[model samples]
Target: MSQPTIRALILDDYAHNAFREAHIERPQPQAHEVLVRVVASGVNPIDYKIRSGNAPYAMPELPAILGTDMAGVIEAVGADIKHLAVGDEVYGMVGGVRGLPGSLAEYLAVDADLVARKPKNLGFREAAAIPLVFLTAWEGLVDRAHVQAGQKVLVHGGAGGVGHMAVQIARALGAEVFATVSPGKRSIVEGYGATAIDYRDEPVAQYVNQHTGGKGFDVIYDTVGGQSLDDSFAAIRLYGHVASCAAFGTHNLATGSLRSATLSGIFVLLPMLTGVGRKHHAEILGYATRLIEEGKVKPLMHPQRFSLGEARQAHDAVEQGTGIGKVVIDIA
Candidate 1:
């Protein structure tokens, strides 16, 4: 008898190298893991960064499969996996980081605690897109900022991946959501129930005075870094909370200190990189499933489609910013 093999795209080296297809031995579930027959893979900015060797912190070693988010059906459950079964549909930001295999293969042996039930209202592609960005948004707004009802919440880059999710989640949490977006993408953020501010047209001080009466927002989520993160500090209310997923750069905190505002830096991949907080990712995804079913959240998908072979183009779409919504690769 021979062991079964699965088809996968492997990256031999970094520096903008392309993925090549190969047949590798199929992975079996170890304890506390599950074998998922991945149907769709979601491509995030991190995906491209890892592929190009820019994200050294999360980059896997060479000859590695690389994908971060996926939605699929469970093929086999490992020991002590009581919450999921062999046939359950699931979605999560499971792997593709250092010390873990990715979802670019036909089958993935993923941590059982990192995934949750797929939303009944969403297909595998849509469900795949929800995990990473949704987790990032929820971790910042709910866990870090503790957003409250009737509070004013502003999302920097509200039309982008994490920004859009923050807008929707904040609105669902009963906050008055405002998002800074380009003029053309005003409809995109507005459709998610956020009031869109043209960040280019209106200066921070001007919009702050007009929309908030110079008081600033109660909560601000900055997905756009650099100047946008700096603007967040200047635009936050006294004693407000500012959460940033893109706070990787250096910035002065004098304004925030003067306002007595709390600043939270979010690195969504920390759980995947480290062994801690893996279950919390699943719990957050569980909340996302309920929110989706309740009609309070949904993924905005790009019109373009890519097969597993076209994964390079998918990464290109995200890296080049050519797509209007989440880019996904249909793998099954």
Candidate 2:
């Protein structure tokens, strides 16, 4: 049999521009891998940052494919893979960087450890929107902070991709969730079962005192880092836990230290970048599927659709901050 050719969105170099209709070599599954026919791909800010040469960690080899999250059906399973069989619907953050093939292609040969059964309640596009953001939120809130019921939790940037997911996850976990957003997004943030605080008009200290009676939040999750991370240090109560996925700045930890609060930083790309702890990511996806099926967790997807050929536009949408929710590329 002749090798098959696949249509993929390939990123040739680090620039704001990307090209579509690139023919790439299709890959067969390794013994522990499964071949997936990609149905949808999710776009993130990191995708565009890497495209523009802003993120050093996303250094894909030249002429690479650009994507991170995807949902699809299994076409074939490798000999050693036991959990999945052909025709199983699945989703995961497969690749697009670090020498691995991404989900922008019509097909992907990914390790079984990097994927999970898609939620029975979600379509391919919705499922594609969950893996990366949900996994990042889960690891920070559940795995790192160990958030418990009745605890007062505050999430920065509650209207963003990771922030929205974090708010929902914390609410589902029984925390008294509070989220910071702009005035225009109050209802959107509150709809996720969190009290919305307008970060623009309200000072962090004021909100902290108002909500927690000056005790401060028991848990603070920072999705928007830098200045927000520093504010989290001051807003957390004594012995409180703070988790941040985007902590990028040089700042004094004096506030947190004075309050005796603990801080943890989450970097969700480690597994895909170094190939370590890959199974844990799959396990989290499995949990997310269960949550979605139970109607406890739901992804907020943008209404617009983009074909694989319009990948550049999809990247631009995320970069321009025009997407209300996750920006997805439909690959039929």
Candidate 3:
């Protein structure tokens, strides 16, 4: 085979305004990593935050490539990597933070344990969108809440990125799922096999009374956070569990305390940022792969697709909420 040159978009600085394309030497895999030919990269809100230099916790050195999730085909495997080999298609949240190189390139030297075989049922675009959101949802619903059959589960922002995944995961786990959404998004939540509560048209107490018959949900997931998290406290049953991926503000704990409820905060980037729990992310995605192959989970793709060079536009779509679901870049 001829020598390979990596084509990547590099951001020189926060004020650079755009990613400039450049061809550099291809990277070789390390002891525990694999060389992947990137086919697609998922555009997320954090991508824009880091691109604009807001997410310091999730960005690397200057002129970095900033993509969190990618799906690609393996070109070569490191000597120590045994589970994956050349020609294998895979996906994962590889990097873009903590001095680790990101995935907005023609290739990635991905940690082997951070990646799983891409579900045979999903294309590169759909698979590329699965990592961060899916891991967040899985950590909240399954790991923290211990969601089980016959439980009453409520997912806030049910039509959103993590919200939609939580809804489907709850359904697949045999929980009776209810989702809070705006009137316009009721159909979207309901389409995922959950009952949709119009947060605007109904008050928290009213929905809690009507849906749970004044009892409350066994588990409540707050993907929206802020006031939604307060509502979650009121909506949860005595000794129930609540999980929030967007927990950032100070709030009164009396509501949860009075009910003896427990709240779990989810920050999925801990693994990537610290490198301590990286394998769990890969394991969660492995489960998602099965859920996807079984037709129990699906990606809600954005209407507009992007090219490798239009990453800025893709980031805008995600940040502005102009896209229907996920905005993905076609890298290959």
For model 3, how big is the CA root-mean-square deviation? Answer: 1.4
Q: Which stretches of candidate 3 lie over 4 Å from their true place?
A: 1-3
RMSD of each: 0.7, 1.0, 1.4
- TM-score, candidate number 2: 0.98
What is residue 119's positional error in candidate 2, in angstroms? Answer: 0.4
Model 3 accuracy (lDDT, Cα): 0.91
lDDT, candidate 3, 1-332, per-residue tens: 86678889888888764798999779999999999999999987888888888876777788788899999999989999888889999999989876778889999898898899999999999999989899999999999999999999999999998999999999999999999988888899899999999998899999999999999999999999899999999999999999999897898989998999999999888888888889888899899999999999998889788998888889888889965798889999
**TM-scores vs. true structure, each candidate:** 0.99, 0.98, 0.97
All models: lDDT?
A: 0.94, 0.90, 0.91
What is the model-wide C-alpha lDDT for candidate 1? 0.94
lDDT of 2 by residue, 173-284 (tens): 9999999998877888899999999888999889988999999999999999988999999999999999999887787999999999989999898899998999999999
Scored by TM-score, the top model is 1
Using TM-score, rank the candidates from best to worst: 1, 2, 3
**Pairwise TM-score winner, candidates 1 and 3:** 1
